[model samples]
Structure formats: C-alpha cells, structure tokens
Target: MDNGRAAMNLAVLLALIVSLLFAQQPKQVVVTGAVPDAAGGSLTITGENFGFVPFVTLNLVPLTIDAVGGNRIVAVAPIKSMPAGTYVLTVSYGPSPQETGSFQLVLGDANDSRSQSSSDVPAPSISGASTDAAARVADRVITVADVDREWQRRDPAGYLGLIRQLYDNRRRIVDVMVADELLAREAASRGLTTEALLKEEIPKRTITMPESAVVSLYQSLGDLTRGATLEQMKPALRAWLERISEPEVAKMNYVEELMKVSARAEVFLAPPRVQVDRTPQDATLGSDSAPVVLVAFGDLVSASYARFAQAFSKLTETFDGRVRLVFKNLPLVGPGSIAAAEAAQCANARGRFWQYHNAVVLPPGAVDAVRLKQAAADAGLDRAAFDACVERRQYQSVIKDAIDEAARYGIKSVPSFLVNGRLAPDPPPFLPPFDFLKRVVEEELSRQTRKP
Candidate 1:
C-alpha cells in the first residue's frame, strides 16, 4: 500500500510540471482591422487576443497596443506613411499574418475622388456602355449625325457642344488637306516639288539622340507592348513622342515632309554611273560575271565599316554570286592617319584582307604596326609577306585610287554601298538582314532583266 501511494504522488507531480510548461508558452492572437489614419479615421480590426504586451506588425511597420481587453479592439491606427498608389493591406500578428484585400490611397484631393466616381459611372456608347470619356466622345461623334437627335439630349449644351466640336474638328481636317494641296501647288510652281522635304529637313532638325535616351526609349517600348518588337516600333514611336514633348517638333515635321516629297518624286539615275572611287582600281569584284557589283566604300577603322561588311557579306551570299562585292578602302582614321589604311592594303595583299579587316574594325584591339602584324598572323596570313607589304607601303596607290573612286561616286563616309553601279543611301535594318538584301537584289535583277 505504501509503494502504490508513492508512485501515484510521483505521477501527479510529473503531470503538474508538464501542464505548467504548456501554460508558460506565448499565446498568439489574430490582428484584424483596416489601416487607420491619425486624422480621426478609424480602421476596424477584427481579431482575437490583440494584447498590450507585445507589438503587432502591420506590413513591416510595428504597432504597439497598451492592452486588448476585448476580442474586437479599435486600435486608433498610428500615423503611418503609406506608399503612393494602390496596395493590399496585409494585417498580421506573431509569425503568420493575413492580408485584407486591396486598398487604394490616391492624391488627397476631392477632385480626384470625383474623377474616380466619374470613371466608375456608366456612359452610353455607340457599341456598348462605356466608362471612358474619350471613348464615349468618339462614339457620340460617329453615331449621332442627326441635328434633332443632338438637340433632344438631356445635356443640350454638352451634347450639342460636342457635336459642334466634332464638326469643327472635321472642318479643320479639311482645311489642313487644302493647305497641303496648296503647299504642293506652290512647291510645283517653285520647282521644289522635285526635292524631298524629309531629306532636306532631317540634317537641319535631327537632334543627335543621346545614347541613354535611345536605350531607355527602347526599354520602355519593350515593357509597354510586351511583344511589339522594338525595331519595328522604336523609330516611329521615338519620332512621335519626341515631336510632341521636345521643342524640336518643327524640325521633325520638316523632315517628315521631306520624306513625303521623296516618296512621291521620281528618281532618274543615269546608266553606268560612276561609282565611288573609295576602293583601289584593282579592287577585284567577288565574281567576274556577277551583274550586281556592290562597291562598299568604307574605312576598316570605322564602326560603320564592320557593320556594312557584315551586311554586305550576307547580301553576297543571299544573291548567290549574282552580286559581286568590291570594297573601296577610304582610310579616314582621322585628320592624317594613313597607318590603318596602309595596314588594310597589306592585309589585302596577303589574301586575308577580310579577316584583318574585321579584326581592326571591331572593338577591343589597337590598330598600330605591331598590332596589325599580329592581327594579320591571327587571320592566317603569311607573316613575312604581311610584314613586307606593310614595310614597303605597297598598296598606297591602290588605297588612293579607292578613295578617288569613292569621290567619283560622291561617297563621303565609310560603309556607303553602291548597288549595281548606282548608290544605295542607307544600310538595310539588320533585324531580317538576309531577306531585305535578297529582296533588293531580286528587284534590281528583275528590273535589269526587263530592260533588255
């Protein structure tokens, strides 16, 4: 009997100790409420055991309470500065917390509220009910043609005024067309119709777009349109936005007009046109029988040179021997730098001209005597032959002849290409490069075939 009583007492003590341990642990509670403003606005919090001891965290901000006497506590929300724009209020206590749907904090103005309400309100539309003012206005103009219908509307001034605005808008459009016609007539009378307005204006008005601006604009379009492809949209959008925001709109308008004039005007290029003598007279064509001889006038040192080379190479391949590429080396390294031109000529002699050409033109290497020799060796040219050519300055005359050729073609820059014997003004946009070159080559070839 004594042994039994002792065991029973021991067991009772162990149970009491376990119960105490459980009781001493921290008890968690739910914190519920709308975020409160210090300015007399109350956010109702619905949760249990929001006690005064420990602080409750709203978002990442901590809110302290004196006590939670009841399950429902109206904690006057602290003067918390919230982020601008819309956000969901996430209320929490302890480790795990809950979110209280979405809430919005707008510009603290009555007008903003009114605008929000107006946006929410349904307005009649030509297609269906609309909440957009711009859409509604556009629809009303399109559908409501009858003057009686316009007058019978509840808001007479609003509706009739809108109608009148539409009429006036159309009248202005007609006026603009008439003005354009008159301008064209005047240009014809003055012999200005033959010249392109865009061509004339771009050089005068084109703001050299900052590199950062171009990149930023590219990124912005990428973000907005999702899949609209930057190359397709960038030039047009950049011109449009810049025209509206920058003070350079007039210049842009002039350039646009020049383009329009160019589009409408007929171009009569003479046969067997004197191509730019930028390259050497002995500058061999890629193929003897290739009818389309593309004479590329560029310096290997110019960035535009590498760009054009890549484009021209693709064009050569696309045309499949029909296009013979002849590069004219116009060595404009700077005011008096013939070293690069001399090096390019030497490379040409070694049959590794293209290889050395690309190396010097691209970034990441210096174009000097030693570097040029190394580049030639790297391009698989015979070292001794390459060095001799450089030392002797063998192709100086050839280089000069190339420059003369370019001058004859009226070429002034590196990478200017002559299609057949005629000059093409710009490089094809590189996105679908092969297709573009192929199309041009095919068109030119077809035109030639039809001639005879």
Candidate 2:
C-alpha cells in the first residue's frame, strides 16, 4: 500500500510540471507579408498566431475579414477609390500585440483584369492646355503640379506651415465629429438624450477648484490683476477657472476614456514631409552611423535657437548613440549673426566647433567682434589664427549656401528640424518639447529596425 501511494504522488508532481510549462509559453503575433489578389479588391496576409478572428486595419481604416486561420488571413482591401501608394497594414488578436507590415496598392480600370504585378494602368493625357493647369499664359500652360513645385522651391517653410495648419484643422474637426457620434450612439443605447447624457456625466467627473489653488493663481497673476486686491478678484478668478475647467475638461476626459475602453480608434493621417540633404562639411554631433540623423537649421544669435539648444543637448543625452545632430547656419538675424556663424565655422576648422558653439552660439546676447574673440579664447582656440580666419570671412560662402538651402527646403524659421530625411512637424511658439523629440527619435529607430 505504501509503494502504491508513493508512485501516485510522483505521477501527480509530473503532471503539474507539464501544465506549468504549457501555461508559460509566450504569445506572439507576427505579420510577415501580404499578397494582393489577382482580381483586385482583396489581399491575403500570411503570419502566425492569428486567433479565431482577428481585427485588421489598413492605414487605421478597418477592413472586412473574409476568412481567418492560425497562419493566414483573407481581407478585402478598400483601395478601389484610394490613391495609389504604399500603406501600412496591421493585425491584432485578443490580448496579443498588434503586428504591422506595408504593401503597395495601385488603382486601375474596373474592366481591366490582370495579376497584381501587372502595370497596365494608363497615364492621364495632358495634351494641348490641360484642364488641371494652374494657369495658361497664352498657350504656355502652367500645371498645378508646376505651381506646387515652384511654391515648395521659393517658400518651402511657408508651404509646409500651411499644410500643417490645414491638417490640424481637419484633424480637430474629425475628432469633434467622432466624439459627437460616439456620444449620440452611447446616449441612444442608454435611452437618454445626448444633452441629458452629458449633463449627467460631466458633473460627476468635474472637480471643484480648491481655495489654495485660487490663492496660488492670484499670487502668480501679479501685475496682470491691475492692482486689484485678492478679495475683489476672488469671485471673477473662481468663475473663470471653473468655466474653463469643469464641463469641457470633464467631457473631454470622459470621451477619451470611452475611446480607450469601449471603442478602438486610431488616426493615421500623417503630416507633410520634405527631404533634407546633408553634406560632409556640416558641423555634427554623435556617430555618422547613428540610426537617426537630425539636421537643424537655425540662426546662431536667435533667442529661439538658444532656447532649443538646451533641449537639443538633453535629447543627445537621452538618445545617446542612437541620434546624430547636424547644425547648419541660416544667419538671418543680422551681420553680427553672420559674423558669429563664421567664427563658429572657423572654430570647426580648428576642431573646436562644439566648444565654441557652447560659448558663443548657445548664449543669449549681442554678437560683436569682441564677443567673438572672447568666445574663441574661452573655447581654448589659437586667438591669432581664429581672428585671421574670421577676418577673411572664410565660411561666408558656406553660410550663404546654408541660407539658400533653407529657403529651398521651406525652412524660413529658426529651429527647423529634419530626422532621417523626413521633416519634423512645426512646434508651437519656439520649439518642440523634449518628450516630442524623443518620440520622433524612437519612431525612427523602430522604422529602421523594421526595414528589410
């Protein structure tokens, strides 16, 4: 009886170990590649760990799932009306991480039946004063494309700024529309009017401003109060604060929570991007082989650039070896700006660009002959050689070229940036926050890793 009991105990121990090992297996979701259907309007994705039914999206737009299996998924591509371009495809399963891949989809005639690799789509004819032309200067037609090219060449910065503004406005409108629709649907489901639903929800989420907060805000206002005492301003201040913070803030937070928990929404509308060139003569930081190369066009004496310089240094430290910074001089402030840029370049020639940059370019003050010499001396440069180099205006042509390049690239403002040939989005006021820059670098690194 004792031997039988011992054998049963050993058998139970073995079974428990096997169950634990199976439970510890890692979950994986990988989208390897996709093949467009020969008949068009659909695609097959081959991958692993696709659950019974997986959600698929192309550029954040959902697709109808036709079929699904553990390693293959068939989905209808809604690219019949979309413009011809490459799009990102993603797949997600319950509790498994989403995987992304890219594929090219081309638009063609409805009757034309060809394989996915066939390129039989005919180009649009542009003979004899095209209707799409921006202007017809007495038979010399200027197409819309021609106008766009000219605009980008002459005022690249302004062109990009306009594009960004348009995108922002469109995005904001879309967000409001989506939120409204979501609220309407949710209210209807709960048998309540939209206004009534908001009335009920917003109040619960709103928090009243504390007395201490009001006092602190009053103290910070200082001269903005127009010599009014705290007691006199208290009611106005509290009312203003409550008006800005209560219903609106609460409603926004409630919508955000609903977006995360109930519905999954993703925005894939990308900003306009421009290709920026790099040269061998550029003053640079970090390794040449770094995954991200950030090119900054700036005026040396500009206060905005000086403010950004601090954030730039922090970015380098945070990203470490993953990012490289290439500085180009725009020198738009004045002659003193030009002189300072030249002096920095002179220091670059002596292998002291960063040291001179810290002393001269990163400081907020007037740039003059004395200040230039003082900065060179502070950077431990040979004063005589540096002075001669600056007197000759050695890098004036280099600075001129940089300014011309900036104009060509539409970089009219100080502290413009490009990461790996893609233009960074314009920031509010002076410069982008450090966290925003960090996200850009991390995204570039991830993209590089995803490349074939």
Which numbered prediction scores highest in lDDT against the true structure?
2
- Residue runs of model 1 more than 4 Å from their true location after superposition: 1-272, 275-285, 335-337, 362-371, 428-440, 450-452
Write candidate 2's Cα lDDT for 70-89 as tens digits.
68999997555665454556
Worst 10 residues of 1 by lDDT: 96-105
- State residue 331's C-alpha deviation in candidate 2, in Å: 1.6
In the order shown, the candidates' Cα RMSDs to the true structure are: 24.2, 23.9
Off by over 4 Å in 2: 1-168, 175-260, 361-368, 421-423, 426-433, 439-452
* Residue 58 local lDDT, model 2: 58
Residue 86 error, candidate 2, Å: 43
> What lDDT, from 0 to 1, does candidate 2 have?
0.71
